[model samples]
Target: MLREYLQALLFIFIAEMGDKTQILAMMFATKYKMSQVLLGVLIGSFLNHGVAVLFGSLIGGMIPANVLQIIAGSAFIFFALWSLKEDDDEDEEEGVRKLGPVFTVAAAFFIGELGDKTQLTAITLSVDAAHPFVILLGTVSGMLLTSGVGIIVGSKIGDKIPELFMKFIAYGLFLVFGSMKLYTSLPEHYINIFSVSGFIVFIVICSAFLIKPIIDKKKKGEKSSYQKAAMTLHDYMNQMKSNFDNICLGENKCGHCEGQNCLVGYTKDMIKEGIEQGTITNPIETDSREVWAKKAFDHAKIVDSLKFTLKYLMDNYKDLQKRDMSNAIRNSLEMALFEETLEFHGDINMYLEHIKEKNPFIMEELRKSL
Candidate 1:
């Protein structure tokens, strides 16, 4: 029993190194209490492993070993393929009710453990051991330890690791396991060729799904850049306003600036200070003090535009982050800054052009200075 327990623990520990359960734990830990999340994961894993052990014992009693091996291998391959095609959006919703850390963590772990490798490992261990309870406890403990580590460490590791690389590793592991099962089941057949062909087909299908989205996003980014570059000052300001308004009034709340104050309010304060401190430089070109005064009075309009743009960025930031578009938030902020600066320059140029037409002497004097 001790030997069987240790073996089950070791196998499960290794198998769950970077599994979806760990990933989910890490993700939940970032938003909820780690203790709560850990509790949830423990409960879920315990239940899952228990079920696997019971099912394995029953099946072991009824089925032939060779047939069971083939079925397990096929299931592993199918799951790997499914994992490769899994969408980030389908996982968990952000900011929905705050489930106490324990409950949330446990729930996430339970859901994630369904038909997972660790569960399968538990089943395998159950078949090998005389006492299934030992296998269940060992596997559950191992899974809990791994998932606890993930929750404690947070999602930083996941952020650093590329999803594609993880997917490839997972596929490779599943393929190896599947081939071993196939070899065991059909010793006389050409199993290597069959396994290799299946792996290739799996890779092709995954590539088709993953590559298309990446290409589409790249194209969309290029188009956005082009549109930004071509926008006039008035149009740019309008866009800024639109972006800000979206942030303030949109359905999603910005994680960074939620509860106390809206981003729109924050931006209005920033603009007000910028104007009072004379840091808010206008793009309009004008030499006359009278024209300068008029533009300065238009500061109200500028404030309104800033509020609109900031709100939009904040709202979109929430959406993008929820969608696992981490870089998108930063990119959108940078784009907003660029458009703001361009609008400022355009306004100054508009004033300067007006001055050049109405007061050629003043324009000539300024041109000479340049």
Candidate 2:
């Protein structure tokens, strides 16, 4: 029993490491808790291997060896096809099952383990009669150890592994095993044709799986380009608003403004003070008082600067086709800066603050576009 136990343990554990059920274990780990999935695998294998050992010899005798091989071979071939057809939870993973996560995992593991090579091997190894139950124990331990590894590793690398590709490799193994069994069981003359045809089909299936992700990414790249452009525009506007806030230094000490108050009126006196502070430039100078006033940053000049910013918004948004978005930004600026009247504060910082509040939605829209 000890020798049988070690043999079963070693053989089944090694066989399972590269099996589809191992991949399934990894997949389940991504959706459910690792502990729960491991428990499910253990329970599922215990039940499956126990039953397989109990009926091993009886089933073998009932069906001739050649017929049994063909039956098992054909079953795995169907399994390969079914595995390929089963969709993975990539792109958008679903929430945990309502059917109780442990039970869901256990049921899936049990179902998937049926007619699998490891289970068949368990049946064969158990035919010795005396230590059938012992063989079952060893196999269960082996399966649990292997499945535990799958669950742990899958949890770590699930995001990086392409779900469809993992399924293909798993299914490919099953297809190869199935075809080999079929080839061995069939008469000699039929071997070459069946072997060649199965090999071609498996190659085609694996190639398709490998290429599908690249094609899908290429398609997504076109849409993401638009999103990238939109995000870039949104980010640029935010940066420009930051530049505007820092455009002047005033007595306010915030570096945003040095005005006496946020509500200070735009006047020639204040403009001359700003010029002396280096916040404003003397664009014109003249002997006449009226001509000197023309160079000042006053109420009219403040309103013109605001209008210029609006035009800037529109110009930058020319490609978006959504003038409403730009208009919304403009409206926020009006509400924040000029809500009561064009009576301006000469301070642009408050205007920048308002735009910041309104600018968040553009980023939200950019995310949705992706």
TM-score of 1: 0.52
Best candidate according to TM-score: 1
Question: Which of the numbered candidates is closest to the native, going by highest lDDT?
Answer: 2
Off by over 4 Å in 2: 1-37, 52-57, 88-143, 192-195, 198-370
lDDT for 105 (candidate 2): 68
lDDT of 2 by residue, 51-108 (tens): 8998875676676767777776776566565544433222111232455877766667
Model 2 residue 310 distance off true place after TM-score fit, in angstroms: 33
Instruction: Looking at model 2, report the run of 10 residues with the lowest lDDT sum.
Output: 287-296
lDDT of 1 at 195: 69
What are the RMSDs of all candidates, in order?
14.3, 17.2
